[model samples]
Every structure is written in structure tokens, then in C-alpha cells.
Target: MQSATSPLQTLLDLINETLSLILRTSLTVRSFAGRWQPLRTKLASLQTSVADISDSPHWAENPLLYTLLPNLLSTLQRLKALADQCNDTSFTGGKLHMQSDLDMAAASLTNQLRDLDLLLRSGVLHQSNAIVLSHPGPGSDKENLSFFIRDLFTRLQIGGVEFKKKALESLLQLLEDDDKAATLVAKEGNVAYLIHLLDFHNQPWVREQAASAVSLLAASNDESRKAVFEEGGLGPLLRLLESGTTTLKEKAAIAVEALTADPENAWAVSAYGGVSVLIESIRSGTPATQTHSVGAIRNVADVEEIKAALGEEGAVPVLLQLLLSGTITAQEKSANCLAILASTDEYFRALIIQERGLQRLMHLIQDLLSSETLEHVLRAIASLSASEPCARVLSSSTLFLIQLAEFIKQGNSILQQISVSLLSNLSISISDGNKRAISSCMGSLVKLMESPKPVGLQESASQALVSLLTVRSNRKELVRDEKSVMRLIQMLDPRNEAVSHKFPVMLISAILAGGSQGCRKRLAVAGAHPHLQKLAEMEVAGAKKALQRLSGNRLKTIFSLTWRE
Candidate 1:
């Protein structure tokens, strides 16, 4: 009793005791011979007591030492039953089952891991408890040592494919927690292994859990992402999106999400028709499936053709339906899809309104106004409104300028983008009521010019302002609004190419709006800006002269600067 206890000693005791309990159960099952003999009574007693104690919430608070020994024993009993059912003879020393050896080993390994988890969670084992637990050390700590021991032992015992799959799944149950998983993946160099499981393992859960690990690994850094894809991660995930169980589909969705995060990843998903599968998953999968599918698709929507494919895939109808009938998560998917697709051409915009998409959007708003929807309805609404065509809908007899104005006043960034978009649509020139709505939106437009922006938002604002400038009347209004002009000038640095192009024209418009003197000065400055220097010369020289000049010294300078590195 006076003896001091060591960490390794305590861990060994836990492991040995757990193994002893497992041996006792296996021995009893074997000695009884009959699957349903007196031993069945003993088994029933054990399982009931174990479940009763484990299910108590307070059990997590005060973990009893060796408490997990019973669960491990029970789980081993379960493995024995599974083995017997399958005619698996694999047992102590791997002798009982020959043909079934791998399967039996896999099942027992899975159950054993389950037992370890219970012990660690109950705090009876003072180990670095996370199965996928990360960072075994502040470089030197007691818990870290435990994790190191557990992970080391688990990896050391890797067996056949089936056995490895079960063990990996149990490890994932440990690593799903981001902190632990991040650490575990780093140490194991598991990136390549996880990618392989997506293809080699046939069981849905095994691949599903493996996908989760892969996703985590890929999300860690460029090195892991490259390791996974280099090992053929992309193709298997696309295939799973086609036919796997919902759980596997979600897992695949997550992996796809991780792989496609970097712009480089967008091409990977794009290469083998990945976009088409993701779109279909969003349109037709279960609610949970759609949530993840939409997330993956959204990650890479920056590529335009991919967005158009998403639209033509009948994605809008299903997304709209989900918004109407599914959960809050479903509504979010629907809205996000709209936001992504809103960047597409006007045909879809006309389809959205012609198909009464506008009415459904308004109805969604009314329901939230009427009951329990997420306030992000306003965000989805703004995406729709961002299409100039959607502004036409806002000006519809059924909609209101005030609501659009309110969105400009208070909607989130996505909504603000669409609101500015709707204002830009004023150039379409509709009815008397529409004109008044457009004018009302003008004031709202001025308001958004002054608000804080989300990432890439100011670009959307800039394009809307530039689009508005083309409208003769709207130009005068925008020009008169000093706040709007200043904001556009500031947005010369927008992330979008189209918006960046708008800068020159909008800058000219702003100067002209400032008066004749302002316009003349802008013209001179435009003449001086590097881009303008050539344009001024070309304009004075005509098309051929401009072309020749650009192809001369300017071309050399451009090539030398870009090619030098």
C-alpha cells in the first residue's frame, strides 16, 4: 500500500485487466458450447448491468477505475457471438477460424477498441484519451504518453483489410473531434492510408469513416491535401456520391469539401464530372445529404461553367422544394444554391421568376416573418435580388420597394449584393410602379455604399454601381450621391474581374458626375495611368497604331516582368 505507482504501471494494469475480462467471457462462451446455454443467462446478467451503469449521465463525471472492464467483457461477448454466427473460428492464437480468421479478427478488434474508448472516456484510464487525440505532449506530459502508447499499440497490430477497417473506424470515432484528429493524422502520416481506404474497403461505414479522416487530413495543409489526392482520393469520393449509403455520402461530401477547398481542388472535382454528381446529390439526396452536397458544390462555385451546370441540372427546383418542406438546414441549402446560381446568366433568373421562384422566396420570407425560419431568408432573398432580373421581380405587383429598401438597410452581405443588383436592373425600364420602386431603391443604394462589407462584397457593390451608371437617369442619381461615388472609388480594388473592369468606367462616371472640371481632370489622370498611357496614344493613333505600339516595347516589358521569375 505504501508503494508509489508509476504511469506506465497503471496503464499496463488497465490493459491487462481489460484483456483478462475479455478472456473470461470468451472462455465461458467456448466452454458452454451451446450458443443459448446456461452461459446465456450469465451473459444477459452482464449486459444489463453494464448498459444500466454506462447509460447514466453522471457516470462521465466520476469514472470508476476498472469500470470499463465489464463493457470490454460484454463487447468481447458480442464479438464471440458475431464470430459464431459467421462460422468464424478465429480465436486465441488465431486458430479457431481458418477461412474466417480475418473477419473474426476484425470484429474482435472493433469491439476491443469500443471497450478502450469507454475506459478512456470514463477517466478511469489516465491516458491521453482521444483515440485520434492530437499532440501527445506539451512535448512531455502524462496524458500525452497514454495517447502515444494507445496509438502505437493500435498501429502496431494492424492486420488484414477487414481488421484494419474496423480499427480505423474506431480511431475515427476518436478523431472526429477536430483537435485530436488533427494531431493523430499528423503523427501517423495517415493521409495516404485514408485515401486508399476510400477505394479498397467495401463496407460503407469503413470508407465513410476513412473519408472523415481524409477530409481532416486534407484540411490540415497543402502537404496532406497533396498526399491524399496523389493517392487517388478524388475518384472514389465521386463514385461514393453516386451509390453509397447516406452516411457514406455525407462522409464523401466532407472529403470532397476538403479536397476542393484550395482553388487547385476545384479542378480535381471538375476533372471527372464531379460537379454533376454534387449537383444531383443536392437536388435529390436526403436532407442531411443535401446539406453536405450543397456545401461541397458551394466551395467550388467560383468556376463559372460549374455554376451553370449546377443550374441546368434541375438543382433549383429541388433546392426550392427543400426550402419549402425540409428543416432549417434544408432552407439554408436552398438559399445557398440560389446565391451560387444567382451568378449565372439571365435565363435562369427569368426561370426563377417565371416559375414563381420569386413567389416562393417571398413566401419563405413571410413564413419566417410569420413563424420559425432562420433569419438568413433575407440572405437568400438578397442573392435572388442581386440578379438585375430579380429586381424586376421586386418591382412586381406582388412585391414591395420598401422590403427591398429594408434589405438594403439591414440585410446581410449576400442580401446587400442582391439589393444593389436589383437597383442596377432599373435600366430595364418597366412600369410606373417599377420606376417608383427603382427610385426608392436608389436611396437604399446610397445606404449600402456606407455599410461595413463582407469578403468580396464591395466588388458586387461596384459592379451594381457601374451597371447603374449605364442607365442615364440612374447615373445622375448615383453621381449626385457623394457617398455612393466615394464607395465606388474605394472599391477599385474588388476581387472580381468584371468588377475590376468597372473601375475605369465608374471612375470616369464619378469624375464626370463631379462636373466638367472633374471629368476633364479624370480624363487627364486616365491619360496618365499606365493603362491609359497606351489607350491615349492608341486613340490618337487609331486601331492599327494602338495594336503596333502594344505589340512593341510594352509587350517586351510585360513578358520580361512576368517571365523573369
Candidate 2:
């Protein structure tokens, strides 16, 4: 308590003390409303003589605690610095009250920013305005804002928990602006940010939408790819190929598809162990994931390391398991993988066949035939028939034979054609195993021959039946049994090329091979014994003539009444 001083000096000292308090409160970057209006009133009373002092360059810093002018960029910086401080734990721990203060300050500062933005747009002030936006330079330009934004983004990227979250939210919001949005999210830069979101974000919607945005932003840009690698985006994506949520995993896979189109990215994906993940995903993921993952792997399947990695991953067992468990799309992809292996690795092909791969393929074909999923069934069958071991695998299934018979019983000409082709291949390359398989399917083959249809199918049918006669156990039962002799003779009537060419050759071969057991007895009882004897005598008497007549081509055309002219 010193002696009383002059009234103006008291007021000046009081104002200086209040400014000290102002400095302290702002050190934590929080606003203080206590006595704010009263102080403002007091400061306003004293500003009459403060006019010339305000024109100083530093006047914008403060006017003895009556800081005004929303256009002052300093105030905006102060607000942002406060947000950063609040985000930092150490800065806010001793200052819980700072958050509310910041909220208030931010609200006020935001209003001022809006006003300043309007003023800048209107060009009403002495300062350079939005026109200055058209041509950017070093000082006091939009370029500074760009640099500031980029710095904020970088800080957020490597920042701690709270700070990083705030940084992301702020940056995301800023991107909603049209002009400011383009500054950073140029097509290429967006890719980096988006890949990071896929790699790091735990929110599904966030990851999904960010990935979608990335898709649009990267639509044509060849740049920004380096940003993806620098952010460690590839490894996380491969890992995500397994564990991410449905939507996120899909987006991540699509992103991988886009990035891996470039050779370097394909290598990058492989180097990150993507092949194993993708192959395993075929077994464990949803049908859609399996499909997409297969496609992803196919993109790099030509790479030796990627292919070797897939093999080492025990993909065959998983693929087999998927054949037992997966959806149609998964089955398609599994078939494709098998095709790749069959063409590229003989040992792998042998391994799959040894594991009853052909049995499963045959079973799948039957199911597809039943379901009328023809394209996939054909593909699976094609995959099977291309290899010898696959044929061995083919002989193991009795259920397959039953289904083939039913397929022919349906009397679908196409099904008959396929069955004939399959049986012919089997009979032509006869093995003990194949005979057993044909025994299973022979009933179905006999049923197909009994039905009536186009002449073209008869020749293949005859050839197939004749080959069956080569097996002694099946001969008398098939040839002489149940009015089959009449069908066989009618099939060779020369009205249809198929029957004409195939039936006689096969019939003559069967009779010669037969040499009159139950077939001769049955034909004698059926009253065709003389006809057969004559045919046999004719063949014996004119061997070369018989051969030439058999060799002459027969062309018969059968038109369906099923379709209208």
C-alpha cells in the first residue's frame, strides 16, 4: 500500500494489470468471460486519446485489452493454437477450465472468421481482398493457408491420440469446402489419405466412404502412388483382405485392385505377403471376398514369389475345403485356381487328383447340371478332363454315374452329346478303373440310346456302345437284352448319319466280338437271327466292299419341330 497516486496513473496501472491477466489466460489459449464487459467498457472510455497508437503495425496485437478487428489473422491463429493446446494432455491437464473457454473463444472466433471472410470477399477493407486470391504470392496470400493446412495435416498424421483425432476431424471438415478442399485433396493426395484410412481407421463407414472418395479422386491420376507406400498402406490392405468388415474389406480389395494394376504395386502387394492372405481368404471369406481375392491374386499370379507363396500356404487343402463349403462364386474361383495349377505345375495337378479332386469335380458338375448352372459345370469339367490323373479321380464316384444316366434320361440332346463325348473318351482309353466307372454310367448310356432324336447323336452313341461291347461282362446283357436288338438295327437304317456310320461299324464289331452266346440265342428267339447271319455272311464274303461301304460318309439332317418358322 503506497501513498495514493494520480487518478490517471491508477487507471493505467489497473489496465496494465488486467493485460497481464489477459496474457496469462491466453497462454493456455482459453477465453475468460469474467468481468469482460466491464473491462471493455472501461477500455472504451480511455480509447479517445489512443487513436494514433492504433495505426502502429503492432496495434492489431492488442489495444490495452480491447483487441478488435475480426480480420486480424493473429486472432485466428490464437484460436487454432488453443485447439491444439486443448488436444495435448499436458497442456490441458492443469487447465480443465480451458476447454469451455476454448469453446466460447472458438464460437466467437468462428463468427469473426465468417465476417472477415465476407469482408475479404466484398473487398470493402483497405487490405488486399479475394482478388488477391487469383494470384498467390509469398506474403499474406492463400498459399500461406495452404502451407498452414498441410502442416496441420502432417502434425495430425503422426500426432498422439486426441490431437490426431482432432486433426482428422478438422481436415475432413475443411475438405467439405469447395475451394479449400481442392488445395490438398488433389486427385493424387487423396489417394494417400484414403489408403491411410483403410489401413488405420477402425470405423467401417469411415473406411468405406474414404475408400470410395479415394476411388473417385484417383480416377485418372498416375501420381500420389508414392504416398500410399510411404504410409504403409499395402501390408495393411492385404491383412484387411482377411479380417476387415464386409464393406471395408470390399473397399480395401477394390483399392488393391486399382493400385496393383501397376507392376510395381503388384510386386509391392506380393512383397507384403498378399498372395497367402488372398488364397486363404478363398477358404475363409464370403463368396464375394473369395471372388475378388481370387481376381487380386490372379493379377500377380504370374510372379514366381507370389505363386510359390500361394503353394506354400497350403492352398490346396483350403480350396478342397471350400469345394465342400463355399458358394457358387467361390466354387468358380476355386476351379480357376485349379486350372492355373494344372497348367503350370504337374506335381500340384497330381496332388489334387490324388486327393479325389476329380471326384469332387464330377460331383460339382452333377450339381451344376441339376441346377442348370451350365457354364460353371462346363468349366469344372474342362478343368478335370485336361489331365490324366483327373480321369483317375473321375472313376471313383458312383453317384456321378447315376447323375449322368439321369442327364441322358432327360433326353436333352446337348446332355446326350456331352455324355457321349465323355464316355467315348473313357472307352477309347480303357483302363480297369475306367471300366468300373463306365459300369456305373452304362445304364444311363443305354437309356439315352433307347430315346429318339437327331441323327447326328446316333453315330457318337453307336461308337460309345460298340466300345462298351469290348467289355465281355457287359455285352449280352446290353446287346441282346430287352428289345435292344431292334433299336440297334433301326439305328443303322441309313436315315441318320450318326446311326448309319456308327451303328453298323459298332454292331458288326460287337457281333464279331460276341461270336454267338446269349446274344445269338436272343437274336434267334427275336427272329432277327437270319438277318444277322446274312449280314455276317455279306461282311465275310465282301470284306473290302464292306469296309468301303462302311467308310462312305452318311450325312443326315434332322430338323426340330420344337421351334416355329
* Winning candidate number (TM-score): 1
Task: Give each model's whole-structure lDDT.
Answer: 0.54, 0.51
300-375: candidate 2 lDDT, tens digit per residue: 6556677677677877766766666666665655666665665576666666677777667666665543332343
Which pairs clash in model 1?
Answer: 89-96, 89-97, 90-97, 134-180, 386-418
- State the lDDT of candidate 1 residue by residue for 189-282, as single tens digits: 4455566677777666667767777766666666666667777788888888888777778777776777777677686676778877987887
**RMSD of each candidate?**
16.0, 16.9
What lDDT score goes with residue 497 in model 1? 41
Give per-residue lDDT, candidate 2, residue 43: 34
What is residue 233's positional error in candidate 2, in angstroms? 9.4
Cα RMSD of predicted structure 1: 16.0
The number of clashing residue pairs in model 2 is 1
- TM-score of every candidate relative to the true structure: 0.48, 0.45
